[model samples]
Target: MNWSSAEIGVLAHAVSRAPSVHDTKPWSLEPRGDVVELFERFDVSLPRHDPTGRDRVISCGAALANLELAVRALGWDAQTALFPQPGRGDLVAQVRASGRAAVTELTSARYSAIFRRHSHREPFRLRRVPVRRLRALTGAASEPGVQARLIDPRTETAPLADLLEYAAEVLKDDRAYQRELTAWLSLPPGAAERTSLPWAGLVRRGTRVPDRITFASRLAQEGLLVVLTPDDTRRDHLHAGAAAQRIWLDAVAGGLVASVVTQPLHLPEVRAGLIEQLGLAGYPQLILRVGYPAEAVPEPVKLPVVQEEAR
Candidate 1:
């Protein structure tokens, strides 16, 4: 039942390319007989930015989605089980090949997008995303206990903008947060920049905060999908990450660009405000801002899906 070298290659490559908080790559892949276990690496810490390790767990969930998709793309029916080990808290998921299966067109497209998808943080084109495309993006995130809510630009933009601005203001003054940024900035550069770490609109010391009205105007032109879950728990965060990546890949396949926004939602006040402002029935885990790119950009370098060893 041990996976062949080719199978391990596919799984490792997909998991490595998953988008993570600050490109921390907070998960590892362990290929066992017929199954690949996804483990969260507790050593990868972002104490100031992700104080509760919520973002790190969510990042692992994103890796989980990619792993499953890779399995399907490899012509297998993937069977996924979460938290399969009772005492091993770091074992987030285990995906095994249930049977051989034909790869469907939908699965193929998503798998192809895994290498192409990267964060687009700059302003989008002024044109609005077609309503139909928005529907498809939301549908991608429609897993159990998960709901994708599109922020209504007309009615909800102003309040949401206010909350984001407040979060930015608070983080800007946080000395510890500033220190964390300084350290991250000091890290030696790596090639993963293209596949990860191109986020914009985050709070940084001395970064000018836009006025609420101006920020609201900017937000109204974008298509934002808020991924929510009924309860906030470790499992919920993991599910949210999976949903976020699914929606993101859908956007990429549809010729759109998007970036994830979880910095603001990390604040309790901003999280509470979103539920009230948007009349949401669940806790917002993250936001996917999707739209056409305002300008062309170089594609991320595609990495070979090859692994040297399996643990």
Candidate 2:
């Protein structure tokens, strides 16, 4: 059950790089001998943005994915149990080093991507992601009770844009929500004008959303994936987040950049609309925009490495 300083460092490095809601990193880690425990922090809440705290749980799920990958990349057989303690809702997952295994090229690539992956909020390069590559990305996310689907630019773009437009309107009108969003962005007083670019991010106060047609046109050129689960539950949300991180790491390792879009999906109506319009087989938890970066890659969000500590 003993862990070396290097082993503890790898686990912390991977988890810190996980994408979270507003970069809140709402999770903590406890390395207990052979088992590493991940806990969801209920203390970190985004009231107006994430009313039900679903996104927070999803964020922890991303961290869980990184933890498992770090364990495997370090040559351990990571046996993960989600919500192992039924009474402790906040404990998201526990990864145990059941045995030793040689690290595979794929696992190493994904683990390396943990640091390379970052949010690319701008438009993608004017190039199409090959159908084969897209298929591989989707396959990486095909976990139990989880499904990753690519949006068809040819047929589904218009309807998808309609939903996004609706979400923009809904978010724009909510003053409290806009205030929360602005606070998170922490935009300088004069910097608001620079955010007018199309597809910069989810809509906020004073940000102009392109018309439906224009928005659809821009979306048509982008590669989008929707992560879903058969039912809406805490378990499902965690699965969705894990699936998302796997796909994202795969994308990054393949020289692509991506970002997760859960803000728009936070609205009940938007979720209902995506399911009905897209004829989705399950509930859409989040949308990931993946593609070749159009310009210089933005720096990855840096976090302090995890220190060796037993809980």
Candidate 3:
């Protein structure tokens, strides 16, 4: 079970492919003698969308899941310790690969999707995802202790849309929020070079801006609106990240594309508002926009893993 620097590099590379909100790969990897630890790297300068760093932790959790799977695929058994230390908030997870465990067929299949999946924000093909496939997605979300509610009723849809629009308007008017968004948005020509949100992923400037109403309307018109909820705790947020990654991988397996929006849900008011307006029972974690995309691409670049000195 001895792991060399080269082996660690390969595993770390695989971990970097996990998805994140706004492509903010907010994590640092530390390699011990035989373990890879993921630490949350917060960017305080950014505005309030992620005030509590829930999304950042979720992003790191997803990376941890990927790291485990990748290590297993490399014929090693990955033992994970989530939130290993109390009071020390930055350490998200520690994974150590040892012995030998063959990767399951399911893991092998999902591994390919890991590299191919990307957040697609563009319009999707006009088609409905089959009920069985939708169920599979729901199961994927539930696996990590999150609930995925698929909004199918027109009445429920209308209210959710309205709430989203209200939240969007609030964000649009907040200069600080706009400035933060602008900082992350990868402009037209240099998007690929930047590690931030790519302009290609954004709706055109003249296009109807994304609001709750607009988002729901678009989902009704071209895709499906899946509301992912959690039990409303910091640990729940971490589970939501794991669920989000699973669902995204399932979508890839089902020949579908997906995108996520947490901006609206970031505000406490918006989260409560959506719960009341939509008459939902659980806390909304993310709004997943899903449909068949025209193309799929590899995930954005991530910082190389810098192994910290052992304690």
Whole-model lDDT per candidate = 0.82, 0.84, 0.68
Give lDDT tens digits, candidate 3, residues 214-253. Answer: 5565545534445455476767777778777777877876
Cα misplacement distance, residue 28 of candidate 1 (Å): 0.6
Q: What local lDDT does model 2 show for residue 81?
A: 94
The regions of model 1 sitting more than 4 angstroms off are 186-200, 296-311
- How large is the C-alpha RMSD of every model relative to the true structure? 4.4, 3.4, 5.6
Better of 1 and 2 by TM-score: 2
Query: Weakest 10 consecutive residues, lDDT, candidate 3?
Result: 195-204
Candidate 3 residue 201 Cα shift, in angstroms, is 6.9
lDDT of 1 by residue, 150-220 (tens): 88889898998888888887887889987887777543343223221122445566566667778888788
| TM-score of every model versus the real structure | 0.90, 0.92, 0.83
Q: Is candidate 2 or candidate 3 better by TM-score?
A: 2
User: Which pairs of residues collide in model 2?
Assistant: none
User: If ranked by TM-score, best first, what sequence of candidates would result?
Assistant: 2, 1, 3
RMSD of 2: 3.4
Q: Please give the distance, in angstroms, between residue 92's alpha carbon in candidate 3 and its true position after superposition.
A: 0.8
